[model samples]
Target: MQYYKKDKDKLVCLLCSYYCKLKTNQIGICGVNKNTGDKIECLVYGHISALNIDPIEKKPLYHFLPKSKSLSLGTVGCNFKCPFCQNYGISQEKNIDKSKYYSPKDIVNIALQYNCDSISYTYNEPTIFYPYAKDIAIEAKKHGIKNVYVSNGFESKEVIDDMVGIIDAVNIDLKCFNDKYYKKELGGNLNQVLENLKHFKKNGIWLEITTLIVPTKNDTYEELEKIAKFIKDELDIYTPWHLSSFHPDYKDLDLPRTSLETLKMAKKIGEDNGLKYVYIGNVPYENSTFCPNCNEVIIKRNRFEVLQNSIKNQHCPKCLYKIQGVYPKMKTIRKTGFAGSFYPQEKEEILKYIDEFNKQITINGSFDTRAMIVPHAGYVYSGFTANIAYNICKDKKPKRVIVIGPSHSMYYEGASIALYDEYETPFGNINIDKEYSNNLKDKYNFLSFDDNMHLEHSTETQAPFIKHYFANTQIVEIVYGKMPFEDLSSLIDEVLEDKENLLLISTDLSHFYTQEEANKLDNICLNAIEKKDMSLFDNGCEACGKLGVKALIYSAIKKDMKTKVLHYCTSFNKTKDASKVVGYTSALIGY
Candidate 1:
């Protein structure tokens, strides 16, 4: 209804450069847009075919929000018919009506629920679904979340005008420089893409360019240099140009995969043409960002993972040279998603329980209190067990506390690090050690930002206890899923090397079992933790946070830290329900 006009007896689509003229019931070049006797109908308006949470680097956007997570979205349609399209299954699919619908509000909520820094319209030509994308972008901007467009540079001037403030960043594919080659091979005009690239820059949108070097098609020296020079002259020299390799897919099966040498050559040409940040993708290369002035490695990356980023305050530490492009803003607050359900939602009530529990516990003599294993359940059921560890460690206060737990809701590989500035709790707000969290993420490849996994009660249940005891110390949360013991243990050992840091591992043992049976299963866990024997855990030592607990045990053994069981109980102790009881325990690991 927005970008269409009635021309005589046909409808003209003004959303793209083609300005497609269609009769009644005729579809545009993009298969999803059709003229239905009255107006242009977007067939895939609410239909989303693919939704994924990916690193910002996976968008091949090196300069935008480095080390942040983006919610990627794709629909089933395209404006071009490139034979060598990497995502042709979705881009070229004809039956797009089968996908489920998610409203614009649904998408915005999903992005927020996952703690995404941005929403990326990727994997296909986003112009084909501009109506859906525009609505989502408008909603996303209201929440301080940015929008990205990974396009083929065919959006009409009218669409660009409409998206001037809504779209924040774009990674447009410049394909090639030759007009004849573009028309014959990609069904697009090269000049149109060139003009749109200039328009995006003129409109103040953060711009990056990509060129999938398809073997002999766009890998020649002449074409690569021309494309590189245009970026320097038309767009600014600071615009990042990504030279990616192409593989044989869909109808382009005869061509060989783009060679590493060709990609390197393109990178050299871009550098020679005065481009500041030229990166090679789809290959094994040191795709790191260097300071243009001093040539120091400011940001080190391994493929999609950032290994180390030394850009302090968005400037190079060595020379204080200011880097270009968008960086992450660490001001998010982890909302209390499970406050009233898992724990108290009022500060007064939480403090009353804390005071009552403190009156019943005393610190054992000279226990160093380096780390703890505490139960995560409602305060009424396991508060005494969990309170024992917190009470013991209250005097030996550390500068920071790292809370590790298992994710019970979402399933994802590796671990999710909470990058928020503050974590919410009924006791009060605790400042998250964002600098330390970023350092760990930079040091390891397995840690990433996946905010949706943080909503689990496994970690949220510990926030109130942390805020109550460690009132001044900062907090860092790590929620793991499908991670190996060695990986997590290695991280634990690293954290313990700093004597001023406290580690809190949250877990609950043996669910919904009879009290008699739970004691047998829970004792095994208690013994294994006390003895620092990982072998005993495999013999039915059940725990919802087994991975975190096991990693702590392994780290304690490696560090020669002794474990002491402070308190142990079952839900039956409070509810008198022996038939279906849950086990809870608390322990301290120290010298």
Candidate 2:
């Protein structure tokens, strides 16, 4: 609300660090604010350029409302000129022809209607529209909605003073530690931004910092260390630092995307500097929060989605150590498992059934196995066959398991990856390996997240067996609806190259056929799998996961891995129903 005194005919604006003085009918450096007649006016007032319901985690505010959703809105125009602006279309543009106007009261009502716990001024610099944001935030507070600012951290002392009471949280972009890059490249002052960061923290705002680690720019170890140490020293050790990856965008099209290795190194530097909460952004699976006391995983996240939260009453469940964040009143625990149906929900009964299945199968000698193809039918029907494969590969003890199966209930292209933190079974929870799963999604454009695909029994049925055998290993489940075999093969090859990954293809042979006919069809599939032949699918091998099986064979053959058939049976073996039966088979692939 502060404007400079009129000197002669020019009125000076002091809202941001630029402090541009304007004449009559002349706009400030930020195109949205102007001097008309006697006063400075925000030209884009009440004009909303972008609005959406987004997870607070996407703002990279891990320590503030960890898993809640916020009604986010942003107006056009920014004071600074960062070359690698991800939202440059809206942030860098000065035009306002396409923006829609929403009053402060109307914006708060929309946030309430969407069940948002907070209102975020994001996508563009909120400082330029401070008056508008202040009005909306004041209105929002009446309805018990918090206010958040996702800014570039170049606001002046007057702006921070105005935001003291209205703003509840903020994510400031601390771009780089180098003052030269801040002034010459980004057209902003680094020291001013750093001083403003301390001001926000001092004003009782829940502050978090984000630094986009652009390759060959601000990604060096020395620069990252300096930034990390500054956060730990100026801000509290509890303040969260989010290191985001930079992609080629806007004027920085020639720069390469930030590598995973670089992001990991930056995270380590922040941690080494004694910052309690450090996270990697723009990269999946690396955004989880851990307790500083016990180092236990407290909140698990996948991109913008919260997979699971183990923190209860803002304390670690394992150590009862207090965590820093604004948490919801009620804690949510995800209950996973095929309870009361697929397998017995009763602990005693499920353990007994697994023990019986183990007795029925004979364990082969230990071998260096890399992958396996197993059936996913009822435990009574396919348990013995599946057991044989797990028993053969139990010695390999791969650190991560990838389960690929056909999606029976939903139809979608490519493959779907489950975003759950853990897949629960009667045996135990199977932790989803987020790092590898996210890396796969990054490498292959075909991989994505779909809740419906994860509901199918094909992939879910394999979890209990994996939990019982590979208890320490993490799992990644992929359900494909109608992906091409060649694309599937390429995806499999990518997983196989990682020596610690154990791939499991889930499929039951020939559904609903006579015992004799099922045998003939199952044998065709068995021979094809052993021979690594992709042509067998053309001959009508009736396996539900024929595409996945073909992909395994194609990749296995190329890697010179050997395949072995462990066991083969049918539902007839359990029910004695010879007229109608489904075939079951198990095999192991190894180098």
Candidate that would win on TM-score:
1
* Top lDDT prediction, candidate number: 1
Report lDDT (Cα) of residue 438, candidate 1: 90
Q: Where does candidate 1 have its weakest 10-residue lDDT segment?
A: 92-101
Give the C-alpha miss distance for residue 276 in model 1, angstroms: 0.7
Q: Which pairs of residues clash in candidate 1, taking residues 3 or more apart in a chain or in different chains?
A: none
lDDT of each: 0.89, 0.85
- Measured with C-alpha atoms, the lDDT of residue 112 in candidate 2 is 73
lDDT of 1: 0.89
Model 2 error, position 134 (Å): 0.6
- List model 1 lDDT by residue over 1-591, tens digit each: 387999999999988999999999999998989999999988989898889999999888999989889999999988888998879999998688654789999999899889898999999899888999999998887566799999999999999888888899999999998898888878779999999999999999999999999877878899899999899998889999999889889899999989888888999999999999999998889899999999999999999999999888788999999999888665689888887776778888888888888898777586887889999899888888898888878776677899999888888899998988889887778878887899999998999998798887877888888877778688889999997989999999999999989999999999999999999999999999988889988988999988898999998988899999889999998999899999999999989
The RMSD of every model to the true structure, in order and in angstroms, is 18.8, 20.3
Error (Å) of candidate 2 at residue 574 is 67
